[model samples]
Target chain A: MTKKAICFTAGKLAELGKENIPDELLSGKGLVYSSPATLAYNSPGAEGYGVKRAGLAVPESVMLIVAPGCCGRNTSLISNMPGYKNRFFYLEMNENDLVTGKHLARIPEAVTEIVEFLKDKTPRVVMICITCVDALLGTDMERVTRKAEEALRQKGFDKTRVRPCYMYALTREGRRPPMVHVRQTLYSLLEPMQKDPRTVNIIGNFAPLAEGELQRYLTRAGVTHIRQIGTSESYEDFLKMASANFNIVTDPEVRAAAEDMNANLNIPYIELTRVHGIDRIAKQYSAFAAATGIEIDDTEEREEAWEAVDALKERYPDLTFNIGESSNCDPFELATSLVRYGFKVDEIYATLSPERFVYIKNLARLSPDTKVYCNMEPTMIYYDMSGSKADITIGKDAGYYCPDIPNIAWNTDIKPFGYQGVRDLMNSIASKLEEGRA
Target chain B: MRGLRKVLTPFAPDQSGAVSVLYSLGGLIVVIDAGGCTGNICGFDEPRWQGAKSAIFSAGLRDMDAILGRDELLVKKTIDAASRIDCKFIALVGTPVPATIATDYKALKRMMEKKTDLPILTIPANGMRLYDEGEAMAYRQLAEVLGEEGNENKEESETVIGQTPLTYGMDYKDVSLEQMKLLGNSKIIAASASGVSFAESMGLRYEAKAEPAMKYLTEDLKGKVLVCHDEVFGKTLRDNGVDLDIATFFTLHDSIAREGDRKISEEDDFTKMVLEGGYDTVVADEILRELIPDFKGKFIDAPCFAISGRH
Candidate 1:
């Protein structure tokens, strides 16, 4: 009569098919558990580069969170971090404001006041972050931000731009979730500029991608100026992102913004998904080389990545892993890659989407009995990690569940991509496992 | 400019307060929001969440769910979660979404009651109000729903109410459900402003004092001081010979309020008080020092997790 967390084996999931995936495995189907894995998804501002941090990705930009007091409550954690001081402001909506819809009117004045408060360090952009209350109200944020810009103009601060950053949790499952919309909002600041064929912008993560094979490949291909929002030193430098001839989209969340850039700024883009499988990484590079008409000799990088994988395999022949979604790599894809590397993946904590069923299908063929637990399932409250056979855990959430195990939280802001990611991740696992033995 | 806060982040809201009070109460606590509210509660506001596990959850309300007023769906979800978890009761904590939609908690409670055998307690705490109000509401609901009558003949035991980590930080003392149920027989010590409000509302005789703030009584002699925290903390200091005036961001009950004591709402109010009030020492969370950078005064760091999320 003891309680247990709900989970399904990879074989059972593949047998049932994506269409019949259990409601417990899929997101937005039940009461979401407040697990550490779901914290970034649930409260975007609490950890990582969620809507709050993502909205402020533009250099010299500040955010004005317009929501009920609750929505902005956890932002104090973000505000306390370095480089975030005096950046976050709030306009708390009371019950009267909710009913009267008068809080929207005050937003313009609030923006003006915030701009005035930071006189010497005036922001180039003020991102007005709105929440579920405004989402339910159907408030036209575009119009509100326009009014705020006009108010600033009248105050002789015409240079400061006002933009809307939707932190709407209600529209999370929609086509443009908060993360996607924030990217579009950030990229929308890019005005038409003279295109530089040599300059390619990395459009995805707010933090700069790790200096690895991708950057080296681009550098060797005669691309002199590679612009990423995180590397941009100033607001003026960030504006130069518009000058890129094309963009390299690293994250799927940034595709909408890349599409916007294509339509408006005339900057074409090529997407490179972060995967762990060494063959897939090489295949993606080959596709990149063909598309860009630049010869990519990835043989050395591929061999190095394989060497790292083999080294780890030799060290821990039957090493097991428990991967969570809060990490840089896709939990399913990472699990599949780990299984293919001749290692056992004990469990994967991630949401099951139909698009990711390919990984699950691959995992089913390799590791049929590997359990998949949706981090957001209500039954996760009873998650007893005593049953986990993982020798080591990866991602912050997996570490939280398995405190006794050696963990490598690969969820850093600086992303790891391509073959470098594969090699680095394998080496990190081996190092952590070795350290555990020591 | 009325609601604009350029100096400070928003303090703990009512939803966080409700969760703090009901967190260790062995109840299946559900915050009625899309997800962010529950995230704020678990991820930031509730310090107990770090090393412990609580049955706190989000209703996982979608835009369509709110727009369409899917009350039945919420009821079904609650019942489903209750069936899976081991809990003594179910508490529905409200946030901005329900407030915006004008959710009738009484009816939701009725619907949930019909579906499950466990007792249901709904706190209609819109995210608009501060944590003190939410804590008071939870205390009121807990007393009304669980307080047993005909306990006047039983031996009296004293229980501290409203000393949650949000207000008292690591020094928070939790009140159990067993203690809550026997409130009618217990002599209550209102440990905070919320507790005072709760005790006052229930027409119960109680002593309002914060035992944690008693440490400040032995501090070095000071000129006129401004104490900004829970009303009970200020009252406790003042009662113990501290020459201080209360300037609380939270509720300052008339009973605890002196002639000079004020209930401040915004950052400017605190700034105006510190700069213009001519006090020698300012006792508050040091995060508020950003507001009165020009004021040359002795500042005491009384970390209130509600104001500044420091432990």
Candidate 2:
């Protein structure tokens, strides 16, 4: 008899709806906020996720950061920010609560307490930020949030609505990971308002923005109507987001949110990631202009960046460099740009993040013999000249380990944005090298 | 516990009027394991075979001709190593790779020791069936060297077994080194040093076994007559048939340092009275209540949770 093999046929996967945007924000009636886990997983960055979760709010808006205590302490840095100092609140969990799933019950109580605390000013919305613990316990935060909202309604708080936002670092594979999901929650507040045909909502965390540089760039690119989430715009501005021709997603993690918006609002999105090299960044802008069919003049601001990079390279042509972090944007782009400007990228220590892997593959094609190392590999110790040979190192926390060697902490916390970012990176490198020479 | 059981099996004492003790023993004691074998299969007693100290030359593989897989080098090295050492016996061990390769360590050991005029022992590096199997192997090997006639010469000596402590401290915490020093300073009778290759290295034989001024000590002391050997330091409560006073104090005072709500005087009182009262009361009460005149308590009961809060 012939052997028969059992196999399953592929079926069409169901599509999830775009994040619900509330009309209050679009109508200038309230505010919308969003937060994200940091670029790396675990450690202080995990705690930073709570800060980002709590800080994404309008003036007088209340937000709750629900996370384990180990991951809760990182909020101190976010609390130091002048704009979000008092708007955030934290709920810390103990090891016992983590295992027993006791913290799940605390969510509704936390929301009620914050809502009551914010009673003086009827908060347009109260967002409850649930971290990865909910993912582990399989806690249905939406159901808990509904119960919280109903309880609030019974207490006569009609205007204040509660929303559930997840910060699940473990769920990075889905079409809507927590990063994009948090953005959806923020934009959901603006869904009730009619779309303003001319206005567009920038769907990404504003913490990475260089002051007002994002709005200036969009304005410079001939888009008169532009609004960034967590900026001056209210929650009402979000409903008008559908009327815009497109959304510009500055971060790669928000690509899924952009796609969800693309499917629902019919607003096309342009992905223009942040960069630290002027010519390459300016080239990226030109590419964005080409894609959007919008024209952008090469203002004097662009020329100054080019001049700074040129002067820095001319002065220090023999500079040896090491790239050690995997930023959201392409690290290989930074590596190649520095190498293009006559610097030897001696060593690179980064992870094989799927998004960042493309840059690494391209770098491999360009410099096949260039020594590359993974973060977990034991060989990283040798990169310090005292151990191995590296003139300059870049990226997160690499500076801490290689303090004796000249280091440029180019990653983590430092929001490398716009044309000025390119100049700043070059200047920072030059300053460190000059100090090393002395 | 097999190692411990093997320890208890009444060996024909080499010397009389001496007692020996060992801790949680009785089981297979296999070594030369990789990270995969943990918990019980492998133990700490590996040979110090690093660099040149490895028993290569004395094991007599000196001829350089056997490196080509003649299998003769194994026998030569085994004999040569045993002969060079002061010991009159050998216990050759195979590494994990050698065990997997199924190299004939047994045949090689037999061939080598016969030529060298000394006894050789082989220890299985794989599955640990029980502790007794290993101790039995060790005892049998020791008997072959010392023999019944040789044991008759002993006047007085005790053989202690197992030197590992209840808690192992490896430099990562405070007081670890101090604790190790305290253990080292104790009146140690005998110990099987980790990484001893030749059989004699397990322990040295006293030339005058019938010597009156000799005392044999076991490396570990678990279930033995609770006696205080030194009175200056403390009483040998072993002779008095008493163990640690469990009720006197659950823990020492240092555990409360830096605690936020610690009441020093009250805690100190609780630590003392409880430990003394509990241990003495429990042992005495059990002995008094027993219906059988010769009732024996084989197992030592310890309260594991007692020190949880104090630490």
Candidate 3:
């Protein structure tokens, strides 16, 4: 099983037709086989570090990752990442613990000791990140965390709280992915408070959004205080998240947490997906404005976004781009947008998510010759690039399959939202193409 | 709840450790569960995976396929992958879902044998066991399934098995220094990710029970200041005139840290002894050398996989 993307020409994909192409992503029919590409897909450069890496976003809060030593070994590398030193702890399980489930009993004491260990400052929360071991063992972490909290209180650390977050990879494709659940788990820390309509809390991204049009638009809409979990200066500032009048979920993963906030904290949220198309993004904003009674004039942003797109078209008029599924935006929709802009988009490498179907149908109608491929498919290793005409690739996974090709590892910890996202992507692609020429 | 983890990231399960045995070997390693098991191994647990070139895929067992036993699908996919790559063998590793559902691996192996001529070995990794057990099991299975029939002359293939990073950090260099001459003709099998000797190191640790390695170490060693890990020390150091009284052993695990009189509870214990005890020679992991501000002593860089965990 070579771990490369399955290479197929646009003509071949067109022949196969959209109806015949397997919906392996959302359908859950993952094509498993021997793999070398799996290595690249899971590499740190590819941002393959799971939710545990993202879950540690809360400032000053420590994570006690309970699993066997094997599971915790990688954290040593992660622990070495800036600011992670000593913030991550472990309560490992052995053969006896795995069978007798005795580790659960020791967790409270472990929490107690961890709390005591962090004497310099009383951490706001202790996130208990559990894995598939508990999924199989069926350990009720809620009850377990309740006991752990009691132990923390027993130790007289009244300022802190212990909460459970599931890292059950087995349940990743279930109702909510592990990253989504972790978002909810992190936000669940905020207790209900009186609404401050002037304040807006942004949930979803672990990294703070760069200063963009959105911040100015929010300010114009009378949003005086914009608090994002990643940008929150302190635990107290995070606690003040409950005071936000509404939540703006920049990612789908955090939408579940937004729903939880709406139910538990009485603060409603508007969900917006990051897209490259100026019109699609503008329409989404209009929908948000209609829903929330907030006027958003994205004319300047939209015009600048088109200028970048048109400039790219003028320079790389005959460019054939390779888009991929592993990036922040939907590869299918991104492909559709590129095709619409008259720049050749002949190849797309992405998993078949349900939302993909919307863009897939459109691409099939407009750009029927565009080839669709799954990165996880076993046959991807035999992807011959000889016939597939491609100049630049978009995502890391796509770049991985297309060796010797200029690729923008567009996936990042930062949120690239709306018209600014389009402008940024066009500039990045243009610079990369110029570098290739030089 | 029978066994749920609250805060702990899933430890390196047997499935991941099992992957280590075939690390450098040009073999197709497939974890039969879902994406997470494979992701956990390739992404986090196995440090050698980055910039690596090995065919390790997850069966991508969907909820329905898992609910209903679908070993045929896996067998078909394995054949397609093996046919594409030049793998020496195919290793099928298991996870929690297969064990809970009781997926028959033996039958799956038979089906796999029908499709490809390459040797197919199944590593029993149910996500329930630790890395040591999984690794030990992988070594045993590889020895039996992949071992070639040989003549009675054992010297021809003097292999030291049961070596891996799990027990020994990058400390094998220090450990090997003590017995360089002793293991000159011999080669380490699977201490860590070395591309040879797929057997495990625990065989040496538990050799006293029945194996001959301990007996071999006993007759050769004269009384001298020795520092070794706890796992192998208990068995090998128990030799006549070679007990813990003559040796200082360091171990992180409290349960197996003791051998007669000597016990090293913490890393500081090793630091204190090495500085003051004035030992003539030391046999431990090379990582300890970094802890000492400066060192002027005889030390063997031994790599033990068992004690390579966070305290």
Predicted model with the maximum DockQ: 1
Q: Write the per-residue lDDT of candidate 1 for residues A1-438, one digit (tens) a residue.
A: 359999999999999998999999987778889998777787656689989998988999999999888888888777877899989999988888988999889988898888998989989999999999888888999999999999999999978999999998888898888999999999999899898989999989999999998888889999999999999999999999999979999999999999999999999999999999999998999999999888889999999999999988887899999999988988999999889989999999999999999999999999999999999998898888999999999999899888899999998899888888988898888888878779
For residues B210-255, what per-residue lDDT tens digits would candidate 3 score against the true structure? Answer: 1222423533343344555544443444443444332223222332
Per-model clash counts, in order, read 0, 76, 45
| All candidates in order of lDDT, best leading | 1, 3, 2
Positional deviation of residue B278's Cα in model 3 after best superposition, in angstroms: 6.8
The DockQ-based CAPRI class assigned to model 2 is: incorrect
Give the TM-score of each candidate: 0.99, 0.52, 0.80
Q: Ten residues in a row with the worst lDDT in model 3 chain B? A: B204-213
Candidate 2 per-residue C-alpha lDDT over A11-34 given as tens digits, one digit per residue, 9 for 90 to 100: 100011112212211111111000
State the TM-score, rounded to 2 decimals, of chain A in model 1.
0.98
What is the lDDT for B23 in model 3? 72
C-alpha RMSD of candidate 2: 20.7
Q: lDDT values of the candidates?
A: 0.90, 0.41, 0.66
lDDT of 1 by residue, B11-112 (tens): 899889999999998899989988888888999898999888999999999889999999999998889989999999999999999998999999999999
In model 1 chain B, the worst 10-residue window by lDDT is: B147-156
Looking at model 1, how many pairs of residues clash?
0
lDDT of 3 at B179: 25
Ranking by TM-score: 1, 3, 2
Clashing pairs in model 1? Answer: none
